[model samples]
Target: MGTAQAATLAASLSRIVADPNDMVSLSDVLRQRQLIARMIEASQGEAPLQQVLNGAVHTAAQGCPAPMAKILEIDRTDDTLVLKSQCGMPAGAIGRTAGKAVEGNPAGEALKNAEPVIDIDVRRRPPESLPDILKDNNVVTSVSLPLINHDGPYGILEVDFPEPTQIGAFHISFLAVVAGVLADNIEKIHARAALIVERDAKAVLLREQQHRIRNNFQLIIAMVQRSVLQTTDDGCRKNLRDIERRVFAMASLYDHLLGLSVQAERADLGRYLSAMAASFDDFYALRTSGIALKIELQFGIDVDLDTCTTVGTIVNELVANSVEHAFGGSEGQITVSMTREADDLCAVTISDNGHGLPAAALESTGLRTVRLMLNGIGGRLDVQTAPERGVKWSILFSDTPPRKRGAAKP
Candidate 1:
């Protein structure tokens, strides 16, 4: 390649990763290959040659004029260039590997010499290393660039040119640059994919454990509830009801944990909130007198387990306290609104138009439990009264960064 073409290729190679599509001009590929080769020769310690090869090839075709370009990882053990990944190739041709190395075929020559090979008249099947099936179907000109890693030859890039006449020294040089980039990028992609797979596998195991834990919790709660009911003493009955309250609190937490799928990396915050609110509604309907309640929510915000459980418990305590103390002798309304703040804090406000917070709530054990839960997540709770009206609890809670779950795990 000429100095200008070489310079362009070299510059682009360094910038391959920054490009959104990871492509480069034809001239750019040539310069990159030369530069990379020098870097490989000069470097002594650990170097990322494989990644360089893949990135080079990927960038070479980024904005290419041709319809297809690809990087194939050569498994010398099998004597074939396996198509690891590519851009602009027909889906039917994906995963297909080029035929084994041959002495005279353009691709084979390039691989054998550890260099670039350009075949202008690829339309006619080359005497050697040509797949008969491809030649019969009118296969044409192709340029093959070999990818050499520190370990050995990693892959090859094959660019199918529309016309045999378009192949030239500039094209060959540019393609070489592309080859080095492909080597590097291919390695990175493979490593990243492997990490993702491992993470997904771990998440699946965690979810399965969560499922079993939830089931066992329900079973134990059932047995406890039954045992409590079998007793007739009023004192014992009261104690069981308190036990049932705590168990239900935990049960609600288990319900959310179990609802997560084996593949999920994080809980669905919106769903958990909706379900928790619904549970509050049901609990009131079943336990209280004629007090009717209403709930409204704005969703799509996510939170971690610690924060979610604390929030749920706080809501349980507040709603139950409202229904128990505020309604006096008639019906009332309860409104819940929660939103995520820009600073990653969750803001919650619950309001009811019954008797305001009892003078004793600030000193009550249940209130203390609620306070402790809020404090655990770096949140604060406050009770307010609307002139001669009911009670409202304004709360602020902080949560851990949202984690991915199942298919959502990136």
Candidate 2:
């Protein structure tokens, strides 16, 4: 502003004091910009609609001075202005209906005509009964700004000035802008609320489907275990154990899905082994008599689906061999660890602190299959064992494209 106008504004503002109850043009604590800023900041997120409305009413009164403000929601059904939120009004005036659409009601006229309605002087204006808002506060002039936008009419914003001359073109223009901002914010809150409900519904449906899938996995496991126990032949029993292990590992993938909102492409190797190994113990629970093998798995990296299947097969085959043959029914421990060999290559070591593999058991079926799976993944196996000592199998593979490997000499 120019020096002359700045002086004029400063002189006009000098009359007002620091009062939260009154918002005039500009006071030490109250100003138009601050009031509008506070009003615009009153979003309808998480907060109840009534609380948001009340906050906006108080903020609207904040100017370099604020006005005594009230918002009367338009009830279309009853054709009345219901007092919803107010600032600087007597407590009793809240929730009172400002009668219905009538001849002389400024607020009612603003809503009805969808335009601005002004009362030059509420003190001298002739109405049989003054609305509680006007009567209870020192309102000399009042402007009823209809809160409307492209959507529809929301309510009426009643801005009350203590002095009649305070109603200027600037004040009316500012109120009009703030009213639109409030209406837009209300509509946004409604849209977000609807979306939140829809998202919650989808989560419920997903959990239900996951529960059914888990049930199916348990049923399959039960059938495999029954077959393993019923068979007397060692070969048949071993084959059943293999099938049970595969199913157990597959179920681990399902369990992983239960914890997520979306499906994951990469699975944690350590988590999969923990679940599969636990299920493996349950499968042998009835047959094994003496010491159980305690399996401890360390940190594992994320791997794609194919790598998971390959690793799952190799790890289970090794674990099954230890459970069936190692310690010969005596107590022992199996330690599984995965570590980065280099930037692109990784290795998993499964070791059992038990009587080492029998000398006669070189190139067994389990070891042979381990070689085959390693070849498929461009991996190499280094087996360490000694009589009366434990066996450690370290399988190394690259996370990048699998390199070609020659078939092993049996």
Clashes of each: 42, 16
Query: What does candidate 1's lDDT look like per residue over 237-348, in tens digits?
Result: 6566566556566677778777665554455555676777777656557346666556666576667776677677677667767776777767778877777775666677
| lDDT of the candidates, in the order given | 0.62, 0.68
TM-score for each candidate, following the candidate numbering: 0.61, 0.63
lDDT of 2 by residue, 1-410 (tens): 22322322332233333345544444533466666666666653466676667766776676313558888887789888888888887777778887565557778777776667777787775656466556656777887777664444557777787787455555665565556666656555666788888877887887888788878887988998899779999989878878887777667667766765544666676677676666655555613545345555655567666677788778877777777777777777776777787876778888887899876776677677778777776777888998678899887876664333333332
Q: Name model 1 segments beyond 4 Å from true.
A: 1-78, 81-98, 102-106, 109-145, 148-151, 158-176, 231-243, 253-271, 281-288, 300-304, 322-358, 384-391, 396-410
lDDT value, candidate 2, whole model: 0.68
Looking at model 2, which ten-residue stretch has the lowest summed lDDT? 3-12
Q: How accurate is candidate 1 locally (lDDT)?
A: 0.62
Q: Which stretches of candidate 2 lie over 4 Å from their true place?
A: 1-55, 72-85, 90-105, 122-134, 137-140, 149-151, 162-166, 226-243, 250-280, 286-291, 295-318, 325-331, 336-349, 354-388, 393-410
Top-TM-score candidate index: 2
